[model samples]
Target: MNTADKPNPAQPHSLSANDMNDKLSGDPISNVLLARWIMRTHFEQFAGSSVADIARAYIGVYSNRPTSWQAVLARNHNMDKSEALRAEDDPELVRIPGMRRSKFLIPKSMANMVFGATCLPLLDHEWRLREAELTLEDYLRIRPELIRFASGSPVRLEEIKSFLGLSGSQARACTTVATYNGVLVRAPSPNPWSNRWLYAAAPSELMHSHDALVDHEQLQWELACHYIEQYGPVSVEDLAWWMGISKKLARLFLEKAGAGEIESGLWLGPLQKKTFESWATNVSESSDERVRFLPNWDPLLMGYSPGSRHRSCLGLDQIGAYDHAGNGLPVVLIGSKAVTTWRVTAKGSQRLLSIHLPDDILQKDQQIIQEAAVMWAERIGAIYIP
Candidate 1:
């Protein structure tokens, strides 16, 4: 990912007293309500939905998790392992290089626009830094070769490297540039259950085609708005960090999107303020105890500013749940707060969910946690061993 120097601080937008009371309350927001809103909105927990629905909702989902597809299917469509594996072959969901240069599964309909919006901006700079000798001419020369090779079938990265007879650095630069240029894409993994993937030409015969080049500024504005809508009460720094752009660019996009600052350093998009107000009302009235077993790299955990929203949910004492790189471990979340780090351990033929809570659980809460764990384990073919 390309990093930029921090820009000057944005002047805080003022909120009226009535606006503050209605949208920005003095009490701390419960992580549960926030989590539910994110899961229901971003993850699309509605029944009878499909993989295309998931892709369309978030533009794309980060597919770095071991069972990323299963997690998406289970959360979004309530699919079990066999069902998710079958759905993986659906032609509408296409994998490509996306935000932060990670693998993402997007709807085939929006692949080109997404590439134009997210990947192109960083490609030239990233490639140049990786291989200073590489140039546009080099990319132009290699484009046809890559398309020809990948046209027959999905090709492995090693195969492309060997066929091109280029050094490792050169191969990486070429592949990245090609992907951003829309000539190629990192194809979906053949096995939905695993993360092993192949490189293939973009606009695969199976993909739904659309050739319009989305306006870069418009896309950036939309991206900023979507982030705020899904992860609002955010800051310019939060949007900048999440989009992997400079803070200056983030501020520009936010302003273009007409996002308002609900409080100092806290921003909300035009549509989100009403949503937040409604959620606040629900939070006050509801006393439901919600538990969820979120997979590693789950967007709910990754979507917000790392130290800001993440810290509030996990608390200072549970800082150990995250690694030095800020990748949050799979967690057992009780009412939006991560109570324990959870993992699946193989025990002979059975996979068992191991819960690692930081503090002792009350007997009643433990029973509730156990039930939710078991339900999640069953969906992924695992047993809860809480």
Candidate 2:
């Protein structure tokens, strides 16, 4: 399990629009990622207050705290904005650096699992070590000192700097060392919206110890199962990209977990095939017309890599849903296709939303979009500027 050797990033291997149309033509499941939306409902079902359920389903969602949770729950469960916002304090969920070394809100049960599978291996690479100018011994030795002040309570980076009399770069480097080694974690934001200033705190027993022994294969296999169950009919390339691992490693995890190939280069976990087929049979063309407003970094938008995004972003090639670096943006979805991107900004004490749409959108659809946008704005205490 030595992950020292960085594998070359794989080229996109997912089916293109034409290839998918020709291959699964007229198949209900082939209806441009609509089935994925339906299949996902299978996992999105949970009590309104159960943030852990949502966290477990997506293998941890990007932690913009409750904004990300609220947008996702509003679409899937019709959850109230206040109810979703309360999830920020749900003890069942813990924030950790998960896939891609990004802060993720995950259920406590899987906190260590994700930390082991994704965060621990960070040490095996030399890049961060080189950037920090610290050797393995140096990194480990510095961890305890860096975490001691923030161990029991959340402390801001600035506070750490002032207390330690370290410069900004030195403080960041110290925290980076602590975080990469799993000693420190990004703390909850005081509010739901801004991440401009963040707190750092030591991980609870959920993450246990930085140097604790872990079963890497078991952790990775469990993650592979979760990915397939939640976002499957995915390509190895998609899995690799999502996990920020190489395709060889991704394929090895998939193979070890006995994932099944539904189409060339596309796979589902062995146990997921039957359930996926059942869900696919229930989705109809009418389902394609459903509209949803997904927040920036929603799992659906981040579920697949560049090659497989066509599943949800069909006909959106001209209007990209993600940035140049592949980070997802707030999107307006009609069925599974992204029709536009949306942004929200503070206006006085309220918020203003602007939905960016293509000129070709139909009048009727525009009306629907407006209505949906207004309703979403009301839920968030925002005004939609048409």
Candidate 3:
């Protein structure tokens, strides 16, 4: 049976090296190029860079991972330990509840604008759909107590739930509303190595003072252009998923941004001709022997709709790299395709990097892959054991 005839019409065609390279010569194909583009386009800062620079680049790192700061720093080759340490105390960079009520590190200067542009619309839509029993006025009634509890410190969500006598779901909704309205900000996780984030009273003085509002339509247009420029050849569905907006809104934003379709379900912004030409030339000259070990939740994988463009790059088996909860895991990529899963394990005093290849891999390819894994391990300060 032809695999192309599968139910998922977006499934990638299995191509020979030359055929893949031909496609790449005109568009993105390799995850390495995609990952490098993301790093260069969004997070290119010099060593010892200020938190302001970090925030200005791509607004902020999504930071849903444990050791979120470390992950961000690690991806940037220029950042050093001192810079990372200094960034921890930089008042300009503030943590906040953002996209889908998840934690994000945003610039305090643009916090209100970012919230207005992204989170508020989502919150409003969610409220309209659910219409929870707790009202905004009800949340305000207990605001002073909540603020007092979190002032000068961080407080966990559970603590707030207990104090307010709210169920988990209720507390979550209330916090989402509170954060959207600038009543609260996400504090640094007490344990940076864990996913346990805390909430604190919004810095009213700073947040309120900088209510510099941009035209909402203009902001959405700008955002749409940014997404396409960074991850184009993307579809409306991809944009909607990435921006947490509906398909109608995504299409409107793209249209306002002057995006044109490169092909069905793939688009490029108005000024992307030079970029497209450059990438095509680069792809034409590139070697197919490259490999990379990408981290869990890397934007290269997360930037597009998981099963659509992602499946085209890595194939259907890539679904196994995600947990049951839909969280992505670290992966091993040969060219654009994810051929295996990988993880680092602690052994004695050193970290051992293990590569788990798919059973279909030939012995010759396995040897080459093992060698590439060793290189990856060395790059990441791990010991490779094939």
Candidate 4:
């Protein structure tokens, strides 16, 4: 990779490496970078914490599936899947369409801000209907009936479709519209791995909060700042891609949020500077070598600009851990650098866990990797295959 594409301050793109090295001599830039993100994501920051606690820290937990969300909670709080995966019972959490119009599990308290920022526009202007013959007028007309159907109890999507006497594209379109307008929400799936979910009327409080119609510009700016707080030291391109907005709009939001350029291209929000300093100091003080097994579509892997994703992969840029569509696959991290990839597959009544490692890895490092892999497998009732 070109030096310009790298996020490491030790290997400056313009200034001589020595000059950049000197500039960050007091505290190593690499350490600061890793520490800042780890702290921000709250990776292993606590033990035995509830799902609601961790949900509050992130803007949204990408709901690829219940298993993916479980992996996030398991890794963050150092708990078993049994505990982490069962948080579907948490009343404070709810699923809604978030960035890029994708489903996300977020705190109910954040419903107004997130829905206004990402989904509200879809209600009238940009209906994401796939093939339904329904118009916006039809959607608005059906919204109340859908909410009334879902008001009494959580209803499965299929059940909602049956009651509406809609099928295929029509059912999908109506449900999508209802969800974006906060008339419906995704309830927990019946099983951890199922793609299907129960739909329910959104909480009355959440609906009322959004009905107030917070100023659009203010909501966007607030969401941008929230992203920076959770994933800062980012660029305009990163913010744009993450929020699925135009670069011009992203720049405007950053400016409005008082984001200062921390480097040539990277910026940090004014509100996060103190927290960033504390994280850097704490990381520098401990600086321990720890290993983390990250799950597919983890935010850390998906949070950066395409050009700057090397920040997390470091020497393993060619690992091809992400699919062509930019969705992250499961990975293994030593500190912030993803050194390898891993996966588990069903084998008879058991699951086989496999780790892809460089042939030249040192024996000690190999042993450490094995130990971590074994612990991860046992946590999920899988058998590690060395």
Enumerate residue pairs that collide in model 3. 25-280
For each candidate in turn, the TM-score is: 0.76, 0.82, 0.69, 0.82
Model 1 residue 72 CA deviation (Å) reads 1.7
Q: Rank the candidates by TM-score, best first.
A: 2, 4, 1, 3
Model 3: per-residue Cα lDDT over 136-201, one tens digit each? 566667667777777777789999889888777777777666666667777666443345667888
Ranking by lDDT: 4, 2, 1, 3
Whole-model Cα lDDT per candidate? 0.62, 0.66, 0.60, 0.67
The TM-score that candidate 3 achieves is 0.69
Candidate 1 residues 260-372, lDDT tens each? 77555767788887776775554433322356566776666666666675456444226356667877567665543456777887677777777765457666556666666
> Candidate 1 at 320: error in angstroms?
3.6
Give per-residue lDDT, candidate 2, residue 313.
Answer: 39
Instruction: Judging by TM-score against the true structure, name the best candidate.
Output: 2
The list of candidate 4 runs beyond 4 A from truth reads: 1-49, 123-130, 207-213, 278-286, 309-316, 346-352, 358-364
lDDT of 3 at 35: 34
Q: After superposition, how far is residue 348 of candidate 3 from its true place, in Å?
A: 13
